[model samples]
Target: MPTPSLPHKPITVSIVSHGQLSLIQPLLGQLDRWCTDSIEKVVLTINIPETDLLGGMRWSFPVERIENPAPKGFGANHNAAFTRCATPWFLVLNPDIRLDGDVLAPLILQAGADSGLLTPRILEPGKSAPEAHRALITPVEILTRNRPGYAAPSVPSWIPGLFMLFRSATYAQIHGFDERFFMYGEDFDICARTQLAGWKLEVAEKLLARHEAQRASHASRRHLYWHVTSLLKVWTSRAFWRYVLQHGGR
Candidate 1:
């Protein structure tokens, strides 16, 4: 738990885990090897309904686990943990992600300049880089592109929430992700809010991370219901409606 040797201000890396105990070690190992000197603290938010096993786990970096009720959605859990972050930069990582050595440093620098929110290029597990980050979300983008037959449309501002690095001040100013969004669309909502608040959202193409996309919640019907409901809520928001009306939804 030694302090990270950072060049500028220390950044706090916050990871949100539901029940991916198997992936936690490897993920932390990669972070320690890759981000050793860059990250100051690694805060793990564990959704523990009763017992707290995270406290007993071994991690290579300075780590702390905060136990809380199983959250309604991803955004809610992250919002809960956001209050405890005191760093200039905060990294929101999923448990199933492994970072490349140079991934976060450049993103942190970009965010420091003008980007309020920055997400790294995400690669599917065991694969090379793929085009995962994109522009803002629209109903048509969600319906048409996300389906099997349709192709994803071009966007100017969308980025995956799997590995988001944001300015702590900007995150606090925007009040973090909307808690109403249980899971899906929360990142989109936050991006939209960032634009509305006059903050820049950037995709750091050079930074890369491998994502397994595996999660306990993603396998359940209850989780699907919450995801759909939250997505609809974000799509139907006033800002999104205006974008839809003006741009034809995609």
Candidate 2:
């Protein structure tokens, strides 16, 4: 008789809503359609007070909703959700992200023993090129990033927070995202820390997910302030500099 295959480790998904139920509705629908078997549960954190729209909805996996009394930062919301994660894999997904098919199966299959974090190739809606596959950040690179003829590194040092799948152990090892990063820059910090802690970051090249970019920082003064301040914090962080030194960022 043939040997039986081992059961796959379940994944718990974490999604934070900043008053964007319209976007989460479609994302939840996609997850329901494509990820029934892979996802064990979803920990949904409502960072801001919003009308209860998801109470009436039913899903294949349990949906644990967290309604915060006040708004929390991006990292704080996800970190709170992470505390509720009971699965082997913990996924942090942006509200605006859309899934067309089973993205989790491929990523889980490709993750090696050393893989700490993994993300699918993220692309903007209606665009062919990938977005947010970024090089290591440095003071010089930040100054010249948008200048004429600046080249990005061949290998990515960090994946954005839009879609990050963390092994539960790795997430615990690194202590999760720095809650000090109110809105932005936590992704880079977490990626840097993960690598510094001897965990490998992997990307599934063929698997694709679409991001409907909100670009809120471009329009909102409060968001822009958060973005700028977070960048400063990241630049001065020990993990960022340590990663740069170890990896030889140009």
Candidate 3:
């Protein structure tokens, strides 16, 4: 086996594959073409082997494939990859997301003195600009944000997991995503934890990427179970109460 070279970039990129070779495969091509100089390593993790992850991968960095026999939850899958990541910063990217521009350079610059949780503006399937980044989750605000005419809060409360960049040390300190959350709320859970620990939750509004988001929770029973359970766990936690108090305008 020939050893592929790694990029000189400081970010370790990871993707948790639920056997979606069709989606992930194309994203790898996009990364290879658009962001060759921006990522140090690419780790593809899966619980099943429906497809060879590196079958046609031709990225600038080394591509790693790890398959776990047992069922792997979303957080657990990424946490497993994080163990092997060797970069100052790490990125969690969904297979359907396509990187088109110099996304990481801007994030790396914005993450300067403070390295918290950094994210970029994501262009959904069809929209003018990207959707607004939201405020922290709260019981009342949750209802309000969904109400007919409520306004989006000024600051970013949480970043979507579609493309999250974390400072390696900060992630280690927060202990990464709480695997307790099988999926869904883990994104908000980690960002909330980072904020409580005094790390800034940054949004690189100037940076851009495309997400062909598959909102599968409502489409499948297993995913729905993980979704609802994670919501219950996060909303009922003591940390959630603290978040509500500090950021809830209470």
Query: In lDDT terms, which candidate is top?
Result: 2
Off by over 4 Å in 3: 1-7, 139-147
Where in model 1 is the C-alpha error above 4 Å? 1-9, 49-60, 70-72, 126-128, 146-155, 215-219, 242-250
Measured by TM-score, how close is model 1 to the native structure?
Answer: 0.83
TM-score of every model versus the real structure: 0.83, 0.93, 0.91
Clashing pairs in 3: none
Q: Lowest summed lDDT over 10 consecutive residues: which window, candidate 1?
A: 48-57
Better of 1 and 2 by TM-score: 2
- lDDT scores for all predictions? 0.71, 0.87, 0.82
Best first by lDDT, ranked: 2, 3, 1
Summarize candidate 1's per-residue lDDT along 79-193 as a digit string, tens digits: 7777777778888888888766767776665554557887777788666657544545655565665567665444455566788788888898889988777677788778777
Clashes of 1: 5
Model 2, TM vs. native: 0.93
Query: How well is each residue in 122-240 modelled by candidate 2, as lDDT tens digits?
Result: 99977778764577776677798777888876668998899999999999999999999988999999999998999999988889999999999999999999989999999888888
Worst 10 residues of 3 by lDDT: 1-10
